[model samples]
Target: MRCEEIRELLVAHADGELDDVERERVDSHLANCPACRRERAAFESTGNLLSLLGPVPGAGRSISARVMATVRGEDPWCGHIRRELTAFVDGELTEAEARPVREHLATCAACAAESRALERTGDALRAWKLPSMRIGLARLFAPPRARGRLLRFAAALAAACLLLAVGIAFFVSESGTATPPPGLLRAMEMLDPATLEILDQDPGLLEIVRDLELLESVTDEEVALLTLNGSGG
Candidate 1:
């Protein structure tokens, strides 16, 4: 290929878009011609500079709008600001991250109204009085180790209660054929044969129940430790 042909294909060569035969011809010409080689280098340098300029402005917002339009059947421009409104309201974003969002909200009435709505929702949540639960429901979602420990503690308590019921039944039976107390008979009836078998198989459970207070104290301390670690993280 001549220098003119090679120069015309330099951009394609720099981008690796030329066919193998065309690329080979260009390479052969470029190696022999200083001017063509310089042209190829310049094309590559220009490409690098263009890449540093980043994506076109509003390109991300345009794509986000299209996606929101498809998924939500709403206007596209609102999608970008709507997604960030919660973070803006919560003061979760740094100033650099929040500036464009703030500017958009200022100019876009719909987005500004949505931001106000989010603020109101947050205020309502903070003001609401939730009912207190004796049991911490948060424990249900604790890390696996914590959850396992809680399950074991619960099992020990349950086994202890079952063992107490069994002891009461024995006491009633041993009372020289006297009629059992009212609830004692009912409790004995509720103690199924399967449960009695489980207790019989796992005698270690009785030991756990005996140290239930210590186990409970240890669990509380560990839970407190875990809460501190999570907050620190």
Candidate 2:
């Protein structure tokens, strides 16, 4: 089987849930593929860890002694086999690969103890239950008061832009000439008549600038309302 197909079967194979033919296919693949073998080990370890909720007996006295010896660098296979025992018990290893591990564990008191401890850990994992979260993730992270203020500020800003657009559209449709809207006429009157004549020569440019100024004015007025409401605070 391909790596992806073999990976999908790894969990079921580890659990002895695969049929003989499927198990043999995964075994054949694992025998030649070290990367798949490692992934299979991880799946088995995760399954063992999740099974920890169940009541499992404590590790044998020999387990701690062996662990201490391995920590002191007294055993050569200590690190490697400790990493693989979970996979071995799950029957995830091929005969050739598992033989050395079996031989070592038989003679090594410390590794055997380590293996028993792992079995207990797996057992406890099987019985554990995770508690449900009471609040949604977003609500848990952001307070409602802060969220409400932020939403109000955003709504006010949007309302200002929308109102400005509607007002500009109505004025453009009605004026249809060089004459400016009441809002723009007030600002235009402040300029010299020569400047106004030059501005009137290009109604398009004047209209664009007028619309931009109106949008800015509307936005500022909305922001002022937010300030009065203490939303900015």
TM-score, candidate 2, is 0.26
**Tens-digit lDDT track of model 2 for 25-47:** 99999999999999999999999
Q: Rate the local accuracy (lDDT) of all candidates.
A: 0.59, 0.56
Off by more than 4 A, model 2 = 1-73, 133-233
- Write model 1 residue lDDT over 1-233, tens digit each, in one string: 77877788999999999999999999888888999888899999999998898977765767887786466525565687688778899999999979999998888776787787567544533432212111332543355664333434333344544444444445444662223345643453355545555444444554454332222323555445433433332
Best by lDDT: 1
Query: Ten-residue segment with the worst summed lDDT in candidate 1?
Result: 128-137
For model 1, what is the alpha-carbon lDDT of residue 101?
92
